[model samples]
Structure formats: C-alpha cells, structure tokens
Target: MVGFEMNDRRKIGIGLTGFGVLFTFLGIIFFFDKGLLAMGNILFVAGVMLTIGMKSTVSFFLKPRNYKGSILFGAGFCLVIFGWAVVGMIIEAYGFILLFSGFWPTVVVFLYRVPVLGRLLQQPFLMSFFDRFTRTERRVPV
Candidate 1:
C-alpha cells in the first residue's frame, strides 16, 4: 500500500523553516536589521538541512547545475554577516528563486490539494501562469 509518514524530524524541520520565514519577514519590516536577518538565514539553512538531511543538502547545493545559485546564496550569506543586509537579502532572493525553481511544480501540485487555497490556485488564469513557468526549461548549454 502507498503511504506517507510524518516523522518527528520532518515536523521539526517544517517548524524551523516556518520560523525562518517569519524572522526574515520581521527583519525586512524592521528596516533590515542585520541581527534578525542573520538569524533568519541561519535558521533557514538549518531547516533545509534538517528537512532533507545532510547528504541530500550537500548534493543539492553542490550539483554542477546548481553551482551558480549555490555560490550566490553563499555570497549573500556572507554579505549579511558583514552587515550588508539589504543587498544580501536581494541577492539571496535571486539565488533562492534559481535554486528552488524546479520545485515550483511540485509545490503547486501540493497546493492544489489544499481546501481553501486550492480553489483559488486552481483558477484557470493562475494555473496557466504556473503551467507556463513550470514548462520552461532552465538548461545551460555545455
């Protein structure tokens, strides 16, 4: 039988990720407070690692196709640490989009299963937009 399990580790990971997002939002609201932003960044990375495990996290960031995003993300973190919160967050946002672009479709699929949000997201216009985005290939010519 097909099944899914919600283990403790996964639950903790999800909680951490949610907190990371909250802290990041608060940082922006607080005029890009460096301390909050740094904490957010740390929590976000830790959440991802815990969510996927160390091996998977390393492989994901180290993959040749993801090198650009990985590098930018790392640089952004460094910038944040060095007190350039605004610029670092901007760079991190771009890097985040690049890194998680492939996950959009999966996330959309999951969203479609939700009760309230599903109806909103399933509208033809929204679905079309998401479909177009997910269909575009992001390959680099060797």
Candidate 2:
C-alpha cells in the first residue's frame, strides 16, 4: 500500500529506536555536561515520541484507513501498542532481567513476519504443538 501517510510509520520508528533513548539517558546521567545532559535528555525523549509518529506514518502505507486492509493494520497497531505497554510495565515492576525477558518476545512478534511459512505454521494442530513446545512464549507468529 503506497497511500499510507500515518500509523505504521509511527510503529517502525518507535520499534527501531527505543534502546537509543536508553543510551542517551545513560549518557546524560553519566557523562554529558549538566546543561548538555538536560538537552540530551529532552532530545532523547522527543526522539521516542517522533519514532511513534514515524510508525503511524509508515503504517498508513501498509494499511490505508479507507481500504479493507486497514482493519488488520489497525488491529496490528493496537496489539503492538498493548504488547509494548505490558512489556514496559513488567520491566518497570521488576528489573533489567525481567525487562530483557519481556522485551525480546514483543520485538520478535512485531518484527518476525515469515509470510507463507507463518501461515503454514498457523494450522491448528501445528499451533498447539508449537504452543507446548514454545511454552506459550508468544501469540503472533508462534
């Protein structure tokens, strides 16, 4: 879809740069000069928000609101946001160990789209088999 001007772009941006914020924040807290640190912190957070905006922008191409594909795109958007929020919450409540544990799964579910292989693997029997094998690790492509 080429008409997209919003939505998925926001997601792509958000998905790609979250860790950058971590680095920027750490830099500000540890090494940057005080005034520079404050600016860096603000820039880092702004980058976070802009990344989301980019996701929404790019997603529009993948799922134009006026088209039928929009339904799936919108659903994907909701799920992506929800999954990340839950992951972030888990990390906040726990610590880095839990953070990494929670984070990678979401990252994979969002990024790993194997097309034909994914559909074939989605069969009911195959799904259950992998569900048990994978330990209910994820719902997206599992």
Task: Give a tens-digit lDDT track for model 2, residues 1-142.
Answer: 4663567745654544555455435644664334333333345335545654556535543443324433433343333234433333233224323223434544444433578777877788766655554454574343
lDDT of 1: 0.85
The C-alpha TM-scores of every prediction are 0.86, 0.28
Maximum-lDDT candidate: 1
- Summarize candidate 1's per-residue lDDT along 15-60 as a digit string, tens digits: 8888988998999999999999999988889888887778989999
lDDT computed for candidate 2: 0.45
Clashing pairs for model 1 are none
